[model samples]
Target: MKSKIALLLFFALTAFTLLQNRKITGVVTDEYQKPLAGVMVSVPNTMISTTTDSLGRYTIQVPAYALKLTFVLPHLTTQQIDIGKSNTINVTLKTGRINLTEALADHQTVHRKVSGSYVKMESAPQTFMAPMQRYQPGETENYNPINENGFQVASQMPVTTFSVDVDRAAYSNTRRFLNNGQMPPVDAVRIEEMINYFDYDYAGPSGEHPIAVSTEMTDSPWNPGLKLLHIGLQAKTVPTKNLPASNLVFLIDVSGSMSDQNKLPLLKQAFKLLVDQLRPQDKISIVVYAGAAGEILKPTSGSEKMTIKEALDGLEAGGSTAGGAGIELAYKLAKDNFIKNGNNRVILATDGDFNVGISSEGALQRLIEEKRKEGIFLSIMGFGMGNYKDSHIETLADKGNGNYAYIDNIQEARKEFVQEFGGTLFTIAKDVKIQIEFNPRHVQAYRLIGYENRALKNEEFHDDKKDAGEMGSGHTVTALYEIVPTGAKSPYLSKNDALKYQKTDASDIGKTDEMLTLKIRYKKPDEDQSVLFDMPVKNISRPMAACSENLRFASAVAEFGLLLRGSEFKGKASYRDVIARAKTAFGKDEEGYRSEFVQLVKTAETLDNRKETAQKD
Candidate 1:
C-alpha cells in the first residue's frame, strides 16, 4: 500500500512538471552601457540557460516548477538575482577585474547588486549541466558496424523480410566528406538511404491504400550473369492545405558545443524555412536544451509568425548538452498539446551530443520507444560535424518511428525544410514492412543491396505489435535485389548442404511464370492494426541498356555505394561506368538533385585516384 502511494505521488509530480512554462525576455550590457553579445544568462541549478544574441537580447522558458532565482554568469563577473514576480529580467554587468572562475566561487561577491537585473523564483527541474566537453580529432563521431547482407541460396532462404527505410542522412553526410576532399568511412555509407535519397518517377497510389508498389527486372549492371530487381513504393500525395493540423514542438540544442557558425547559426536559417509554411490551424512550441532543458516558447498559434520568429531569433548557444532531458521535456509538451488525429511531433535539431543525464543510446532508444507508443512521433535533424553522433541519432530515428535528414549546409537545409516540408513533417502511414519471396526455379541465389539494420524476423512481419518504418506524404522508397539466375554462373552464390531429415529442394513448390511475390504491410497514421497486401512479379528481365531510367539510376547509386565501401560483392563495377550510367538516367532534371549526385561521384572518383597515385609513389 505504501509503495502504491509513492507511485501515485510520482505520477502527480510528473504531471505538474509538464503543466506550464513562463517566458523571461531580457537584455544585457556592460557598465559602459554597451550591449554584451555573448554573456551567459542562466537559471543556476536548473537545465534552463541561453546566451545573449548579437543584439544582446535573450528569451528563456522557465518551467512553472522551477525555483524563482536567475543568474547571469559572464566572462567579466558573476551576478545573481532573486525571483520576485516579474516575467522579464533585463541585466547589466558589473565592471570588475575579478577572474570569472574566481568570482563565481565568492558567494557574497557573486550575489552583488547589478543595475537592471531582475529575477523570479517559481520551479526547479532534475539536474544541472556540467562544464563543456573538449572537441578534438576523432572526438565524438561514430557509425555502427554494418555486416552487409550476403547471397542466399533461393531453395534454403526463399523469403526476405525487412522494414522500409526512408531516411536520407547518409547521402548528405557522404557529400560533406567528398566536398571536404576526404573519403567517408566505409560504415558511413548506407546504400539504401543513398538510393532512396533520389526521387523516382514511380506512380503514386491511386487505390484505397495510401501506398502503392511497383517492380521491374533488369540485367545486373556490374555482372552480366546476374539480374537486378527493382522495387519501389510511392506514398499518395496530399495538398498542403488539406493536410492535418500540426502540433509541432521544435526541440533545439543550444549547448555550447553548437557555438560554431555551422551548428546553431545554420539551424536558425533552416527552421525559418519550416516556420514560413505554417498555417493558422497549426501550432508550435520551442524547447531548448543545454545545461538543462527549458521551454523558450509556449504553444503559439501559427498565425503569429513574428512572435515565433522572435523566439527563434532570441535563442543563443551556451552550456553543456542535456539531450536526454530535453527529449523527455519535448515529448511531455507534445503530449500536453497533442491534436487528436493531427500531426503531433517533436522535431529535434541537434549535433547528436548527449553529455548529461540519461545520455546512452540504449537509454534514449527505450525513451523514444515508449514515447512512440503514446502517439507522439520524433523527427531528428542533425547539423555540424565535429563530435557528430550518427549511431546515436540513427537509433532514435528507428525507435522513435520517424525519418532523418542531415542538414550539412544551408542549401540542404532549404531542400529539407522548404522543398520537402510535407514529407518531413507529416506521416500518412506507419509500421510499413516488406517481404519478398523468391521462386527457386527461376532464381538460384539473391542478395539485398542494403538496409543491414532494418531486417526483421519473418514471424514479426505479421505481428501487429512490432514496430516498423513510417511513410510520409509524397515520400518514396526504393530497394534492389541482385539475383543469380538458375543457369547463370556467379562467384557470389553460396550453396548449402541438403537437409538430412527433410526435403531440401524447393522445386516441388511448383513453378510459375512469376519471379517472386512482393508483400507490403502498413498501418494508417492513426491506426493500431495493419493492412497487408501482396503482388506477384512476373519472371521477365530487361537488358541493362534497355531498362527504364529509374532502374538505371538506382543501379548507378548501388554501384557507387559498393565502390565506396569496397564491398567484396562489388564484382567488376568501376567508378567510370557508374558515372556514365548515371549521366544517361538524369530524367527531368528539375531540382538538379540527380545532376548533383553525378558531380559528387566524379569528385569521389578523383579522390580515389589521388589516393592510388600517392600509394604508388
Candidate 2:
C-alpha cells in the first residue's frame, strides 16, 4: 500500500509540472510587411530570452503563469503581449509612425502595432515601466563641454556665422536616455541637432544651385516679447540609381569592449541591412581591428552580398582595440581602389574605444585631416553605450569632412544605412557655411540657439581654405535665432557706453525693410571654389499659432532642448507648452518621428518631476 501511494504522488507531480510549462513562437516584421531580424523576445523579469533570426522567427519557453511576454528592440516601439491561450503570435512592429501615448495615457495597457496603426485591446496586465540603469561599475563615457550662447548686442555683433550641421546623433542619444527612464546629461542636448532630427517640408533646390534656402519669422513662443527667425536649407535629393558608387571600405571594431549584446550582435544585424541596400556597381572592403588590424574581405562588388555579410558575421570580439591600425589599412584599401570622381569613403563602426596605438585625439584628428585632403571621406557610425567616446568619434567626422551618427538600435542603423542611403554615402556639397547679418535697424540683440562648436569667425566665412560642414545629398539643415526687436525691453541687452573709434549707433537701421540678410556658401563635391546664395529676410511677425509647421515644430524642439539643459534663457518655458506646441505642429509626420518626440518630451517631464519630488522628500 505504501509503494502504491508513492507512485501515484510522483505521477501527479509530473502532470502538474507539464501543465506549468509552455512553448511560444512568433514572427516579427516591420510596418512595410518586411521581416525584422534581431528583435528580442523575452519573458519579463526572467533570464529566459530568444532573438528573431534572419527571417524574423523566434521561439521561447515560458511558465504557464507568465501572463505577458515583452519584445524589445531599440529600433522599434516596445511591445508586451499576454500569452493567453495562443501558441503562436504574429507581431507587426512599427517605427515612429505608431502612437506611443496610447500605452502611457491608457494606464499600463498597451496597443499592438499594425499597418493601419489602429488601436486594439492587448492581453498584458497593467504594470509600471522599468527603472533606469545608466552605467556599470568602472564605466566612463565622454562628451565635450558646451558653453551656451548668450544674447549678443546687434549693434556690437550684427552678424552671426556658423557651419550647417546635419548630424542628428545628439537627438537619438538623448532618446536613448529618456527611453531608459533617465534624463540625459546636460551637455548631451544639442538644440540644433534635436531640431534637425525631423524632416520639414522645405522646398528643394531647382535652378542652378544644388541647395535651396528658406526662412520663416514669428514671435517667440517662450518669450512673447522677442522675435524668432527660422532658416532652412534643403539639398536636392538624388535617387540611389543615379548616385555614383565605388570603392567603399567598412572599418569594423571587434575589440573586447564591443562584446556587449547591444554592440556586436546589433552591429551584425545593422550591417546586414546595409548590405541588402547596396548596388552591384558599388564595391565593399572589410577591415577589422583587434590587437592588430587585417583585411577580412578584399574589394568585392555589392552583388556578392552574402559574402560580405558572412565576413561581418564571422567577426568576434576579443583582444585590445587597434583603431589606428584599422584606419590605416582601410584607408590604404580605399586609396588603392580609388575611383576618380566616384564615391570613395570608409564607414567605421565602433564604440570609439581606441586604447591601442595612435589612440590620442590629436593623432586621430591629424590622421583624418590628412586622409581627407586625399579626396577620401570618412563616415563614423557609433554603436553601444557605457564607455562610448563621442568626443573622439565626432572629432574624426568633423575633420575628415565626413558625418557622424550614433546607432543605438537596429532601426537607427536602418535609418542611416537604408533610409538615408544616398545621403549617407554621397556628398553633394562641401565647405558649406551660413552667415546671417541681423539688421540693426530692426533688431536690438540676437542669440543663436545652438552650434557652439561650429561657430566660425567673420573672416572664415569668405576663406575658401577654411573647412566647414559638408552637406549630403537630400539632407536638410535648420537654424533658429531669438532677437529683441528695436525698442523692446529685455534684461539681456546691456547698455554699452558710446564707442570711441567707430560709430555705435545703427548705420543700416533704415536701409531696407529687411530684418536680416542670409548668405550661404557651398562648394561642389569636386570643386575648390565655392558658390554663393544670398537673400534678404523681410521684417515680418506672425502669431505662434499662425506660423508654419516648420517654424512651430522647430521652436518646440528648441524649447524642449532649453528645458533639458536647464537654460537661464528658457524664459517661461514649460513642459506643457512644449507638448501643446509640438502636438499642433506635427504636420503629416509620415514616419511618426514627430509623435516619438512628443513621447520623449513626456518622459522627460516625468523624470524631471520625479527628481524634484525626491529632493523634496
Candidate 3:
C-alpha cells in the first residue's frame, strides 16, 4: 500500500510540473498593422520575459497559472492583458506622452508658445507626466551629441566651415523608432542624413573637377520671413563596370550581445548580398572578433562566392567584444593585400560594443586615426539594437576617413551594396570641405540647418592636413541655411554693442548682388593637397512654390527632423505642413523613396494624435 501511494504522488507531481511549463506565443503591433520590434512582453510579477523579434513575433514559456501579461516600451502606454484560457495573445499598444516631455527637458533653452504667450517651461505644469520606470542596463543606444545650430552674425563670423557628410545611418535608425510606434530621441534625428538619404536631381559634374557645386535661394517654408539657401555637391559618377580593381576586408563582430537573430543572422544575409555583387578581380578577406580577434578566411578572390558564403554561414556568436583588436587585424589584412590605385577598404559590421580591449571612444578613435594614414579607408556598418554604441561607430568612420551606414533589414543591405555599389565602395574625393562666406552686405544673420557635429573652425577651411568628409562616386550632398535678411526685425539676430576697437566698413554693403561666396576644397582619392573652387551666389531668391522639386523635398525632410527633435526654432511647422510640401515635390520617384517619406509623415501624424488623445484621457 505504501509503494502504491509513492508512485501515485510521483505521477501527480510530474503532471503538475509539465502543466507549469506551457509555452505561449504571439505577435505585437501598433494599430496600423505594422510589426513592432523591441516591445517588451512579459508575464506580470515574473522573471519570464522576451522582446519581440524584427517581425514582431515572440514565444515564451509561461506557467499555466499565470494570470496576465504586460507589454511596455518607451513613449508608449503600458498595456496589460488577461491570459485566461488563451494559448496566443496578439496585442496592440497605444502611444503615450512621457517621451516628448523628457525630450523637452533635455533642451534647456527650449520653449513653446501656448495661447500666444511664451511661458517658461521650468514653472509650467507637467502636462505630459507619467509614472517613472527603471530601464534595463543595455536598453539605451548611444548617439552623437546634438545641439541645434543657432544664428551667427555674418559680420561677426563671416566664414561658416564644415565637413561634407554623406552617412545615411541616422535616417534608417529614425525609421526603426517610428516603425515601432515610438518617436525617435532627439539625438537620433540628423537632418543632414535624413535629407541626403534620397537622391536629388542636381546636375552632375561637367568638367575636370571631381565634384560639381550648385546653389539655390528660396523663401523658407517653415518661416516665411526667413530666406533659405540650398547648397549642393554632386560627385562624379563611375560606372560599376568601369570601376577600378578592389581589395576589401570584412570585419565582423560576433559578441555575445549579437546572438539575436536580427544581429548575426541578418548580418550574414547582408554580407551574402555583397558577395553576390563581387567581381572576379576583386579580393575579399574575413576577420571576426568575440573575446578575441582572428582571421576566419584567407584573402580569396571574389569569384569564389561559394567559399565566402560558406565561411559566412559557419559564423556563430559568443563571448564579449574585442572591437579594437578586430579593427587592427582587418586593417593589417587590407594593407597586406593592398591594391595600388584600387579601392582598398576595411568594412566593419558591428553593434559598436567594444567591452574587452581599448573600448573607450578616445582609444578606438586614435587607433582608427592612425590606421587611416596607410591609405586603407574604413567603412562602418551598424547592426542590432540593444546596447548599440552608435557614438563609437560614428567616431570610427568619421576619423578613419570613411562612411557609415546602419543596416536595419535585408532590403537596406541591397540598397547599399547592390544598387549603390559604386557609391558605397569607390571614393572619388577625400577630405572634402565647404566654407561659405556670407556677404555682410546682403545677409544680417544666418544659421545652418544641420551638420552641427561636422562644424570646423574658420582657419581649418584651407588646412589640407585636417581631416574632413569623403565623397563616394555618384554621391550627392545637400545643405540648407536660414538667413535673416538685412534689416529684418527678428528675435534670432544677435544684439551686440558697437565694437570699441574696430570701425564699420560699409563701402561694399550694397554694391554687389552677391548673397554669399561658396568655397569648396577637395582632394583626389589618392592625393594629399586639395584643389579649391569659389563661386559667388547672387541674391536671386524665388518663392517656395516656384523652387525646384529637389529644394522643396529637401526642405520637407528638414522640417520633419525639426519636429521630431522638438526644436524651439520649428516655427509653425507641423506634420500636415510636411505632408503637403512633400506631396508637391514627389516627382519622378521611380524608386518610391519619396512616396515612402509621405507614408512616414502620415504615420507620425497618427502617432502624434494618439499621444494627444492619451494625454486627454
Candidate 4:
C-alpha cells in the first residue's frame, strides 16, 4: 500500500511539471512595418527558440522561469525584450552594416563614426541564430551530380533521346542563392530550367493533338563552327476557372529544423495563398508529420476558408521528422476521398529532412511510385535553406509524375498558385519523350545542351513501360542542341576510324532537304499508350542577329548557366556577352521575368568582380 502511494505521487508530480510550460506567440517586423520573415526568435540563455514565418509570426513553448526573448537575422540588427507579465511580445529591427573585410573573418563587427576619429567599432550583437543557420559548402545541402552531355558522332550514334523537364525550381533556387549574395553550386544550375523560366509566345494547339511544337535553328553564339537548334513545345492551355474539381492533400513537415523562419512560416503563407485561389468545388486535407503523423483537418470544402485559416494559423513546429509515415497517411486520405476523373494530388511541403522512418530516398521514391499508379499525382514545394535536400525532393516529384517548385518568397508562391494556376495543378500530358535522328550526310557531331540525367536510350523511346516526364497545362518546355557541319573540326568530337563491320548508309540521303528528324511521343493523363508525331528540321540556319527572340534569349540563358557552372564546354561565353545578348531579346515585358533574368546576370557579374578583387588583395 505504501509503494502504491509513492507511485501515485510520482505521476501527479509529472503531470504538474508538464502543465508548467506555456505557448507564447508574436510577430516580428522591420522598421518599415512590413512583416520580416526568416527572423530567429529565442529565449535568452536557453535552448528554446523559433523562427518567424512568412507573416513574421512565431510560436515557441516557454517555461515559467524564462524572462527575456531575443531575435536575430542576417542583415538585420538584433533586439531583445523582457517577457514579464505577458505571453506575447512583438519586435521591430533595423538594418545592420555588413563589413566586407570582416565578413570573411571569424568575427563580424558594426562600425560607427566618431566626432574626431575616423572610425569607431562595436562588438557583434548577441544574436539568437542557431549554428545550423550558417551555410557550410557541400555539407548541409544536397544536389544531383551533373555531367554535361558530350558530342556524339552521327555516323556512329545518330539518335538522341531525352525526357522533357518543366520544373523551374532550379532557376528559382539559383536566383535565391544569388540574391543572398553567394554563387550557387554548379549542380543547382539546370540550363533547361533557366531557359524555360520565361514564357514564350508560342502558338497554341489548333489540331487534335494536345501540344503545339515549334523549332528554330541558328548559328551558335558561343562557338563559331557549331549551329544551335532550338525546339519548343506548348501544352494545351486550360483556364483556371474551367479546371476540374481538385482533391488535394497537403503533407507538411513540422520538424524541429522547420522552426526556422523560411521553413514552416513560409510554407504556411504559401499554402494560404494557394487556399485563396481554390474554387468551392475543390476539397483539401492537411496532414502534418513531426516524430509522428496525423491529420489536422478532414476533407474540407474550399469554401470553408475561415476554418482552414484557423487550422493553418494554429500550427507550431517541434520534434523529429517522419516524412515516410506522413506520405503513407496522406496517400491513404487522398485515396479514400478520391475524385474520379478530377484532379487528385498530394502536395508535399518540406525541407526534405526525414530522420525517423523510411528516411532513405530510395524507399520513399518506391512508395511514391507505387501510389502514382493509382491515378494520383504528387507535387513537391521546397522551402528554407542551410539544410535543404534538393536531390531527395526532385527524385520524388519525378517518380510520382508531378512537377516541383522551390518557393523562395511570397512572390514566387503567388506566381505558382495564382498566375500559373492551371499549369501548377493540372496535367495535360504524360510520358512525354523526344527523339532526334541526325543525318550523317550533313552533320558530323552534335551535343545536347543540359538535361544530363533525363537522357534515355534510343530504344526506350518506343517502349510504353518506360517512365518519362509529365507536362502541365499551359507549360512550355524547351531544349537546345549544338550541331557541327560535316568536315568541321571541333575540340569536343574525337576522330574515330570508319566502321569495319558495315558501310555508312546514304540511301535516302538526297531524297529530302531534311537535316534531322524530330519525333515526339506523349500520352493522355489517364492513358497508357502514347501518340506519335514526327517533323523534319530543315537546314535553314540563320545568323544569331537574324534569329527569333526565343532562340537568342534561350541561347543567352544557356550561356549564363555554363558560365556559372564553370563548364569545360563553354566556348567564348562571358558574362558581358550574356548580358548584352539577353538585353536585346527582352521581349514583351508583361510579367517582367525576362527583365529579371537580365538583372540576375548583372548581379552575378558584380559578385564575380568582388571575388576577383578580394583574391588580388
Which portions of model 3 show Cα errors greater than 4 Å? Answer: 1-138, 500-510
**Regions of model 1 farther than 4 Å from truth:** 1-137, 501-509
TM agreement with the true structure for every prediction: 0.78, 0.86, 0.78, 0.79
lDDT of 2 by residue, 1-617 (tens): 99999999999987787558688888998766777666767676654566676567888878777788877655367788888999998898776322333332323323332331223244432212221134543567788899999998877788899998888899988987787667888888888888988888899998999999998888888887999999989999988889887689999998887776557667777888888888998899999998999999999999999999999878778778999999999999999999898989998999999999888779888888888888899999887788888888887888888888888766677678877888788999999999989877888889999999899998899999888998888998999999899779997777777557754566734668898889999999888899998999899888888888999999999999999999989998999999999999988765567877888888899899999999999
> Can you list the residue pairs that collide in candidate 4?
53-265
Best by TM-score: 2
- Residue 151 lDDT, candidate 1, scale 0-100: 94
Deviation from native of the Cα of residue 602 in model 3, angstroms:
1.6
Winning model by lDDT:
2
Least accurate 10 contiguous residues by lDDT in model 1: 109-118
User: Which residue ranges in model 2 land beyond 4 Å of their true spot?
Assistant: 1-38, 42-70, 74-89, 93-133, 136-138, 501-503, 506-508
* Model 4 lDDT at residue 499: 84
Per-residue lDDT of 398 in model 1? 85
lDDT tens digits, residue span 158-233, model 4 = 8999999988899988887776678898898888878877777778899998989999998888888888999999
> What local lDDT score does residue 350 receive in model 4, on the 0 to 100 scale?
92
- Model 4, poorest ten-residue lDDT window? 111-120
